[model samples]
Target: MTVATRLQSMQPTDIGVPGPTPGDMARAFRSVRRDPLTFLEQVTAHYGDRVSFPVPGAPALLVNDPDEVRHVLQVSARNWNKKTVQYGALARVTGQGLLASAEPSWIEHRRTAAPAFHHQRLEAVSDEVRAAADTALAAGLAGLVPGTGRVVDVAALTHRVGLDAVGRALFSADLTGHAQQLLDATSDAAELVVRLGRSVMPTARWAPSPTNVRLRLTRRRLDAITAQLVAERRSHGRAGSGAAYGDDLLGLLLDSGLTDVEVRDELVTMVIAGHETVAAALTWTLMLLAEHPDAQERARAELAGLPAPVSMLDHRDRLPWTRAVIDEALRLYPPAWAISRRSIGPDSLGGTDVPEGTLAIISPWVVHRRADLWPDPLAFRPERFLDPGAGRSGYLPFGLGPRLCIGREFAIGEMAVVLDRLLTTHRVAVPDGWRRPRPQAQVAVHPEGGMPLLLTRLRAERRD
Candidate 1:
């Protein structure tokens, strides 16, 4: 059978049980303003694996069990659609992009975009990724006095790196000028999405509410920027082979057999999904490496062994320890922590009855850190990923099934290049009393105040 068909065929187990009432779910949503993770944990703890929560006028399911998550996200995915509560705002900003579209449209977009992110295509862009990382690293470490200790916001640095990588790899442009604005707009959009999650009713859009205003403004700003980029690429024409600038992902998409509106939607989706998640992933990875000296040392050793003039793309796989570090970090702090789907029909999952229109929330945060699947769930252990059999069902940083991130390979490739380069070029250390920064769930989970790290240049390495 075809992979998509096989995914559709897998059925959920009939394990229906009594769950938290709609009122309880609403109360939890209110509490999420104070702490989202805690609120989700409370629901899971009180209601077991599957719990029903009232969202606006509709009921939703919060599924924490791994098998059930698999079934919802992978198996029986045909019966599920992106919950409007979560994606409606996204659609406003991104239109029918891969992240916002469902069913046939999403499948078509995925198929068309798949070739742009193919392994060979990404490999071709490796140098661009490295150049971006190097630029960010140099700028971040610049103007620091010797032995004075440079306190760099690793999250901001990674954001810049991600933006640079995406711009160079996709559009052949430098995005530094628009970085802060894009970040702010993306953050606002994410907040608006979370707020709308509580009041799932479509009335909010027509009510002239503050949320609606914010949503419209954010969408306008983001689209203006995206449109400008698209226009510039179109005007420039494709760069010749062996030139510094060539027809990349953005160029390919512009040439894709789709309307301009469709291309714009896809571009916006790529900007948000491509840059934000990788930045968050890199930030978290650096924070973990800072805490675990032995792991840092091992990663450095792996980098040291690489041939001179190494880049993130060239020797990513060669450094297993570095890859493991990234894997472990993703397990603990997935940027795309929560995904929601609505049931198209009544179904059972993890022995629970799920009614039609029920919002099914699948959280990688809960599953990846489940004690049953991961020993010492809170610990930063990269070794777990080294073992092929360890926590297969529970680990899903990029997600699963047909809707899995198309940029998965590109993100990994970019990350490996950045991490390898950073480890080899400098030694990163956090402040003595610096606690693990709580992730702020914006478009992606980012360190609340940006991840601060002490970046020390390796004595043998000269600034490029």
Candidate 2:
């Protein structure tokens, strides 16, 4: 052991500060049930960055400083795991997949899944995403009521596009017809699991409550669909005389020798995370664009100049402004709002002693909004990313360290594809007196209301 190890070996010290008592915890829970977003803000304001909350079980700490967050999530990440109440509940849906697993298992699965996200594989799928955008957009526009000037449910539209893109790119299947029904079930499941995690007396999943019953049904349907998809892929593999199957993500997982059960877990995890977060990000991006017409015009001008039937991945280097706009949108509304961890061993953070089994919360929502780290943190400015190192540590839309999202590249590529499609085709605008959406904090920070927007199709691109 080195001298640095000696510091960790020293006897653990108690956190020297005061925190919320049981009564305070009770009060916060009330707010959490009522309005979780506001509850978190109130907690931070009352307790400051390095806060501790004492409850019936282990204590909880909320760390906001970037350095401290790095310490928890990176420097000493090995000593922490996803055994917290939040993640335990999340596992109800995700099972032991990458998001909910720890140690050697997570390491093994990450290694298995890593190659699927390779730039080459993503490049192959980029065309599928491009196709998805075209189809989804044309359908949405065509479905508009006759004589209506492009009123749209932007939230639902983005979701449909995201679902279609992920389906084609990952499974090579069309999740077109039953996708929304499945998506609705999965979403309900997400809300239930999150509520269970936060509840002090979180009813056992097997409990007979209506939410629990719905969650059970939802899980069964999701499992059946994923199982069917995997079975179909396996049949394709068998039919090819044990030849190399297709190179979709499901193919990659099968190739890596993951069992059907393992494949199902990973697929469902992707469906939940990929489908919801991308849609939320796109919804917010369109909303932000509507609020800032100047940025929209600039992006459209850039997009209008691109060749028809554009391939974003092929010409990504030439679309800095468009990428910057998406980046800025992510900064303002990170989908994975709060990251929670449970300390396994004793450690000190920011000179404060953190005991074992402490619930460690690092919120990207709060961190991205810190005024000191980001000048006018609430403002929409895509230029921040135009500068190198803007995203190094302070920006955490994707997060940091070993557990960083393996799908980061995939998410960015998909977002770029959708953004290019929408900006090139239409100008999104809000209705008169449309109030800005309130950021709702759950597993992700998403808009409170399903965003409604007026879309005006851009003029035909000038042929060169």
Candidate 3:
């Protein structure tokens, strides 16, 4: 018998993971969509970890239990494919890149992209990264009315910096000019994707809805950017040799024998994934640091002893506190708040049988906040991560399983370098009377709007 035939035959009976009916689940879906981060907290609190929302298309199994998470994400990962709603919707923009691809293709893409992010290659990329960070610093620190106590939109600056770094890493180009369009367009696409993903009512992209129109236009603009870069790289970046395209993400994708459309899609994925997620992560970290001045001072003190701007290439090993700050921030506000998978065949989760095609949601946001996982899970404690051996089954900032973010080390390293520089140079604090921004779930758990902060240049005396 064929593998597919055997797997289909192995399908289990209907699971007893109790949840409300489709009608009630739709109401729950709407409530969570309103404020997903908070709604998830509320649901997990009242209903316990095995919360299921039985919507029309597929019933979702919301799991905060560690064993279930490990099973779905690791042990039975082959049966749990990325054909779920979130990945399907994201494939509209990213087009089967690492995160969205399934089976052999995903494995292939991951293999091709692995070497570029390997420690040695990253070490080689460090010089370019340092230069990129300098460019980003210029963009971030520019127009800051330093002595006059100007209110800086900290999140905006982080996006700019992240954009520049990813741009350099991708194609050795400065992408700040395309930053706003990329950010806004990504948000628009994500919002529409969520609507299509969750609603019992199906919406087609070909339909001429206003939001659909915007999505199309945004995609075309994004395609134009990727096309231009791909053209430049293929034309002048080695010609017939197929050697190297400046050792960036685009270069690696090009060398992998992917077609033009395939290359374009991966580029879109890299730009969108590489830029904004790190931006959101760093912005939240800085905000949290500002809220706790003591942590900020500790991170700054850690950085004081290390080399100023160059933290990559083995230099980052010294900045544990700085790394911890980013880690803790990621724990509290994981960029990818929810990871969904569809069971291709029979599977078991947290001791319950899962039927074919069930939607299983592993929420990093909810899992990170589990009171049983960490002491005072709600508090900002970077020191918790400082310990090498901590309760880790519940701590999934990037994710778990083979599908864990391939760029985790790169993103964290970039954040480490950027945060070290920012803390060394400034005293960051939230603006007076500014309320905490509500966490919204789209592609990632990003702040609903711009995060405003007051940044003062730290003087020599302020170091102590």
**Best-fitting candidate, measured by lDDT?**
2
Candidate 1 C-alpha lDDT tens digits along 409-432 = 788778888887787767889886
Error of 3 at 23 (Å): 4.5
2 versus 3: better TM-score goes to: 2
Tens digits of lDDT, candidate 2, 127-157: 8888777778778877543334666788888
| Per-prediction CA RMSD (Å) | 6.8, 6.3, 5.7
Per-candidate TM equals 0.89, 0.91, 0.91
Tell me the whole-model lDDT of each prediction, alpha carbons only.
0.76, 0.77, 0.75
| Decoy 1 TM-score against native | 0.89
Better candidate number, 1 or 3, judged by lDDT = 1
Tens digits of per-residue lDDT for model 3 on 1-464? Answer: 54223323432333566554444444455476587777777768877879876443345778889878988898888888888767877787778888777656788878877876788766666555656666665566666544534567787788777777887765677776776777777667667666665544446768998766876887887788789888988887574564666567778888878898988887888888887688889889988998999999988887776644544543357777787788889999899888888889877776777678888888898998888888899899989987887768888877788999988888887887677667777888878897888877767766777788888866422121
Could you tell me the TM-score of candidate 3?
Answer: 0.91
Regions more than 4 Å wrong, model 1: 1-16, 22-29, 55-59, 145-148, 198-203, 236-247, 308-316, 460-464
Candidate 3: count of backbone clashes, pairs at least 3 residues apart or interchain: 0
Ranked by lDDT, the better of candidates 2 and 3 is: 2
lDDT of model 1 at position 395? 84
